[model samples]
Target: MIGIATFLYIYGYKYICKAILTAKVMFMNNLNAPFPLLQSNKVKFISSFSFGFFVFVFLYIFQPFGINEVQFYKPLFIGGYALITFSCVAFSFFGLPLLFKNTFNPDKWTVKKAALYTSFIILIISVGNWYYTATIGQEVISLKHSFLKFIGITFSVGIFPTVIFLIFTEKTLRKVNESKAGNITKQIHTDLEIEEEKQENDIIPQIDFLADNNSIPLNQLNFLCIKSEGNYLEVFFFIDGKLNKSVIRYPLKKAFEQVNELNNIHHCHRSFIANFDQIEKVSGNARNYELHLRNLTFTIPVSRGFSKDLIAIYK
Candidate 1:
């Protein structure tokens, strides 16, 4: 049982590493975009330490190796723990970034694509672990027993936890984005009002039509709205409280291009971009700002770093 478990663990880990590396190489070579790679040494070290501690605690409690018959503080025990920790750290340092690099690229993977990739990776890992465990042992266990054991381990320790984590993270990110958007809207509106009063004119400067593939006539634009469509963004200007509903010319990264040039336009959140001219009112607290734009109300959050900028714009 012990040998089978060890083999499963090792095989699962190696397969995950290889899969991630392959994905990373493919993304870098095939897709030429400036996406962030997963190369955080600090995260790798911390994860390794945590994994090692968990393994140590598990072994200590279970005494799986009949530690009561031998010295618990043996040199072999320390060496084993060290090896596991180092191996995990090394693997994560190389593997995680590779996976992230491939999965995070806007040009390469859409939300559906990313989800499919994750499912495939998980399936491969689970099956690989099961096969390794079933075949490694000398004692012949029934196929049913091995299958059931594999299912139990996978559901309890792998799939369930990962799914829960993803759900929680997604919820948190949504809230954060909403709050940021509200704050940006408020700031832009306040700035616009001040500028308007000074100039004594209601007309806001609009972008002149440029004969470029990227250029859009300012006259054709009405209200800038940023909507999140999974990993992609849907950008359209509202016409009389209705979505103009034109196809987005660029991805989220490109949509944000030259945003600084638009004096009254700013990205309120990762999922939302807004125009100050469209904002009707600002409500909510420091952490959460709500914007009333015509008939629509949206929340924008103020991250700690952007708080000063937000305040300055409003003031």
Candidate 2:
């Protein structure tokens, strides 16, 4: 019986430890997920104001914390709490972003950082709420005690609904985008088959290629591809059957504008203009499309916005 009890106790302890670890990991993951960036100060202010308004309305309706017991000046009392919430939200959304730029960045954002930063905001808000009520409202409560209470209030009212909405909206948007991309991908592939037979490059006349205001006779060289590197453009072409690369001090748009009027020369991506005749292959999933030009090792991307135009070029 003693041995059995010991084993049971050990088993229970291990299970609890494992459960705790799993919860911790899940919490971390939730913190790091991608979240939408609050783009402008105007948006931040509006969001804060909206949240404060919500809290005020909810408090007035629900009358929690015995606000109903107060006969006169009840709205005034609740309004003060609303102002606290607004102030806290404003401080968090406006001020914290500048401090946690990378964490709140749309591209690099993760659930983990958002959660941590949100908790930080909640902490500040909880403190503010507690301090306000204790000092002004004259509620006698410890900061530590008020913190948890305020956090619970904020979470129940704001965070929970926002989280649910974000999750549902994100899933729906992803599904729709993926489906749309898939259709576009299929259509692009069909177009690619027809495009294979088109010989649009034949009519292209040799034009001088510009590099730092210096022009090289493009007719002398077999053009392959042109891609952008920030302020400069990299020109890929063949000279005497040997592949050569030249750096031109020009943006992709400017460089391509000069060449796009020519047959088969097209802007495929934000950073790339490709010669269709030189394209060896095109392949990618719905999210992205890549063009493989002849005599080139790397692939060039095709933007979704330009996908229809690219397909139209073949027709």
Candidate 3:
């Protein structure tokens, strides 16, 4: 009978662990929405209460401790037992996990931390059992022996469930990461398709660039940088992962007129035109400003007049 009672107690909490942990995984994998209760700490307390209620009801029905044992179904005794056990389990679940919040992160999980957490849980359950037994007039013959028994019983209750929770948490996290990666890959493909469609429909009017004997293809993604050289302009662009430069004999105004059709490119100064999307950094005050563009060795000056427009664009 004692063996059956011990088996049932440990087995009951193991079932509870699976129920609550499975619910947690389902909440995480839910595509539409998550349950509100699971979002808050109340779920922990509620889960504990439910498991306590189930165990108490099972014990009530079976009376497994034997007919010689004291009545457990009496209103006062049962209510007090329910209060103590539920509060202990609820506090253990609701509070202890949070105490190691920084350590509990799955990415950096350590065996040392997990062992410590397990030990703490066992201690809590053991103390809770000791308190319950004391309240029921169970006299301590030897304090150390009673403590050892409580530790052993609580260990049996805690170990298997802890293992289940950790395993489920690891598996759930892996599936979530895989799902995220798949979604990200699909999104990237969609974005590329949209941009390709836009390029096909869009057209650039030909501006005779006489600098390096090359015409600027406004549709291309990688146009490096442009600079003013005396009255002529230097148009530096990229092709096939290589840098190409052309000196346009025309003034900056003519180049701006041609490049203005592209939204990502901006005319920032009388001597400079920049692809705003490629800019790495912007520096300087009202008197003098500079735009540092990515993948380019040089920086472009930002004229005082264009500063307000740049600010407005960002805002």
Supply candidate 2's per-residue lDDT for 219: 48
Predictions in order: lDDT = 0.51, 0.69, 0.58
Q: Among these predicted structures, which one has the highest lDDT?
A: 2
Best by TM-score: 2
Error of 3 at 181 (Å): 3.9
lDDT of 1 by residue, 1-315 (tens): 999999999999999999999999887664442222223466446645654555456545654323334443443553354344445444545565476775544333333553554454444444654554356421222233366565555444444434543464455544654666566666676666686677654454566322225454343236556566765555556555565544443555556554434656667666666665666665544233545665454444433344445547666
lDDT of 3 by residue, 47-153 (tens): 56754565456445653332126544344443454465577667666665578566554333344554565577568767776676665635321123377776876
Could you give me the TM-score of model 3 versus the true structure?
0.39
Quickly count the clashes in candidate 2.
8
TM-score of each: 0.40, 0.48, 0.39
Which candidate model has the greater lDDT, 1 or 2?
Answer: 2
Clash-forming residue pairs, model 2: 31-111, 31-112, 32-110, 32-111, 32-112, 33-110, 33-111, 33-112
